[model samples]
Target: MRVGNWIKLSHLSAGFIAVLVGYTSSVAIIFQAAHAAGATDAELNSWMWALGIGMGISCIGLSLRYRSPVLTAWSTPGAALLATSLSGLTMEQATGVFLFSSLLITLSGVTGWFQNLMQHMPRHIAGAMLAGILLRFSMDLFLAMQTQWLLAGLMFLTFLLARIWLPRYTVPLALVAGIACAASLGLIQADGLAWFPATPRFMKPEFSWSALVGVGVPLFIVTMTSQNVPGLAVLRANGYQIPATPLISWTGALGVVLAPFGGFAFNLAAITAAICMSPDADPDPRQRYKASIWAGVFYLLTGIFGATVVGLFAAFPVELIAAIAGIALLGTLGNSLALALSDEHGREAALVTFVCTASGMSLLGIGSAFWGLVFGMSVHLMLRRSIR
Candidate 1:
């Protein structure tokens, strides 16, 4: 427990950015999903509580066991799907679907379905999808400049200068610059800020074929295809050899344990995981897991503070959030795109995947990530057949 040995400023900075980016990007969608399922203010607090606790425990526990950064998150795409599909379902029915989805995820891990699925996925295609998923955030870094030119422009310059001068501290420096700029502009909102603890509110489960088919099944599919698949790809792309089954199992079990309190679908994290796994988190790859452990500590604090934590993050201007996230992910995005198109044969297919995923199209309730994989694989198979 020597502070000097385990603690690094870079690791702490990475962990903080990971949580900050995660909340700023899609927490609104999560709030929408909870409300769609008839969640009250208290229930919404419980949902945040469950999700934060689950992520914190799994990130710390799994990373320590495997000695690698194994970050986990509630399925963002799954939450988006629920926001649309859970419109008419009662809270009890929604809880049932949550439980059912967790069961499927648990089985996927326990039975090695996740590993089997990953085994068949091409590395190039995975990289393509990862790049595609991240491209928008990269664009956002510049897009933020359109509205808040002063704030974002300063951040972009700060990021470039930090990369040149400080390297490992690039993101942290840019974040500080963005926040300082935001505050100077009077963009930070502090209304209704108060301390409060997260309290769990349970809903009794109710099952029906309608809820199962309409909600549970689609949630399972989206969580796996959109979140877990890309998540595993992030791990593989980073040269981690941790077993996928155990990681999946642990996340699924945690999801199930917290479902009654509104933990919907838990799975491996991709973008945030990239932040922790990147070299900016630590100089030595072996030490990067400590970044995830720190992220866990932040998540635990968020859970303990409940709605106050949400409000705290929400207080930051959107442009600042976008600027910081774009800066944080630049390294991982560059590496993914480079590796994806490196092979001559896979180049075209990977491009197709990248374009499709970056397009952010949704059809039939499935997100762009899944469709990107489909398009990429199809093009790859066709190219191989033509060559033969």
Candidate 2:
């Protein structure tokens, strides 16, 4: 198909918003992670470069191959883990940990172990898990209104009106409204913004037993449970049945190649992926892959101009980003809840999943998503036997 035939204004907007939201959300944690390992300014830029390039290639390649919106992101939880754990380790040893964790991910994907495990997850459970994961972002819409009442309120009103009249462009219209309000109120800060291209700085890996055991093992666990699990659930909840094996395999492979350049871990994205898969991206689900493709294009630009892109995103007000992300994901959050509660047999279990996931509970370094699934599935099985 011709590019003009598949791409639309809505697709471009969705793509841009996905990249914007991804970067603005947890980028600070990434900086902390870099600093924890004693990285210099050049090495920090290389980290962003490697992660952007890795996510860009994987998203574009996988989405085109499957004709679905396949979004990838750096491991936020992994970065958080490193931020606290990497203080004692050298950058070289940290690189070794990244490589080790990535190898485990690659083995899981190549052996089809992770995909097979996810296949056993029920549809309702998956929907509930997805809804739970996105609940915070959706709620941030109103929370943002509290701080930047005028800006967020105008964006919310615009979204509602656009949804009725311009269904496909609701998100973009809301975003524009928010930006205009922010600009008028002097919320947008453009100071210190300049074009700075990123250059890759490679570090040699030096393996150690302590780093591998303490950091590598935990990184792999969180990347799988906290990141990849909900990411796959987002795809499945939205009725995209693309195989998980290739998605996992390719991301893992890219992580291995880019780890030396400060790409700690790569995994499928949940929140940003939902933006690309939402109906507002395209009325036709089949063509929604174009959103992810455009996101990949933006990701490439972000990598090429790492510092510039970082400063650009930093210029937007936090409230604007929160409101826009919430408005864009409203449809997806609603659909996930509907699917989760549609079946009377699974309604209670699904609700359990949603509640647990939304609680944001974390234990033993594993996120609430995994625990929610486990608890929900257990309740489901027990309820089934009792009914029988």
Candidate 3:
């Protein structure tokens, strides 16, 4: 490859770490959710297959077609929702709920109603909502240092040096250094490496009314209201000019078809997806779509090596993962915080938004993500007629 092309490939390679971090740091809840729903090992692997393929197709196809950094991810909070709500559900019943909710998502996307509502929302409130969502995860980075100082410190330094010196591959390079330190110190084990390809398992869907009520409806609501809305906001906030409705439709439709086989849910990614979309990763915004493509490729590779890599990531102490993810998000959180505080007229309302979201309250079984949006929007409308 030529020098420029090699640079492109390396940039693409950096995106793999983003995919890995996104999956490992918080997404493990999905597996637990599957287990809670009575999924077997085969069923779990099937879920990985479905989610990987669904995300890969959406990330690759949509990004290429639109020439923007459109990425899809399994909803983390939705997975968390499943982990709690799927406790007594059967696999087939969970699948039924997945399908039902996916249809609702697709309909919402097709109607374009959600986008309209979000568009009318104040920019400050939107920024506040974004900050609130990322606040805990970002704060955890330094907090992680409190527990695993040696591991997190080295990774932190590696990231700092890379950012100051290399500038292009800070997070990925930091991961390399962190892993080396972790392995040598016996803090993490990557001893026996198996690279067997994962086989896809097919699940035949069966519906149950109780599972649909308990699992499906909430999953759909959380994924759409929390994940998809915020993911699109990340794009729009950064001035990515893509049609939200189409992307939403694509994500929902993919989930519907893939859910029965273990694809629990799919939506736009906000935190990790921002990494692929940002100018920091790639200088030219037009070329940033390649990052999402790279993320998709890595997502496929992850599914291929499914359990082995998952073990590798898991071997690293929780604080190590927490520190890495937290530090990685610091820049994003700072920017979001700044945006939240920027609007003078909206500052008070934004504070209300931030406070409500930061409080992390959930009403009607929905998570804080949805409530943050609601409270923030409510405060904004009451504080100023401009939002109303």
Candidate 3, pairs of clashing residues: none
Quote the positional error of residue 196 for candidate 1 in Å: 1.0
In Å, residue 12's CA in model 1 sits off its true spot by 8.7
List the candidate 3 regions with Cα displacement exceeding 4 Å: 1-47, 63-105, 191-193, 199-244, 260-296, 385-388
Give the Å shift of residue 221 in candidate 1: 8.6
For residue 219, model 2's alpha carbon misses the true position, in angstroms, by: 9.7
Checking candidate 1 for backbone clashes, the offending pairs are none
**Candidate 1's residue-wise lDDT over 1-388, tens digit each?**
7889677899898888788767655665577688888888788888889988988999899989998988888787677557656777889889998999999899988997766765766778877776776676677888999999999999889889987888656766777788888888899998877898988888888997767765686577668766887788899999998887888788888888999999998899998899999988987889999999999988888877777866665688878866776666577678779978898898999999889877766666455666787899999999989999
Model 2 residue-pair collision total: 0
Q: What C-alpha lDDT does candidate 3 achieve relative to the native structure?
A: 0.72
CA lDDT of every candidate: 0.81, 0.83, 0.72
The runs of at least 3 residues in candidate 1 whose Cα sits more than 4 Å from the true structure, single-residue gaps closed, are 1-44, 60-104, 201-244, 259-295, 362-367
Residue-level lDDT of model 3, residues 1-388, one tens digit each, is 4657424764585467568667754554565577778887667777777777788888888888987888789887666556656665667777887888788788889997666655776667766755665676667777877877778888889888987898656766767777787777788756654666666776777777656654566566557666887888899987897887888888889988987787778899887788887775688888888888888887887767665654555567676666666666566567767878899878887777677666666555444545666667776777677655
Tell me how far the alpha carbon of residue 246 in candidate 3 is from the true structure, in angstroms, after superposition: 3.0
Candidate 3 TM-score, true structure as reference:
0.70
Full-model lDDT, candidate 2: 0.83
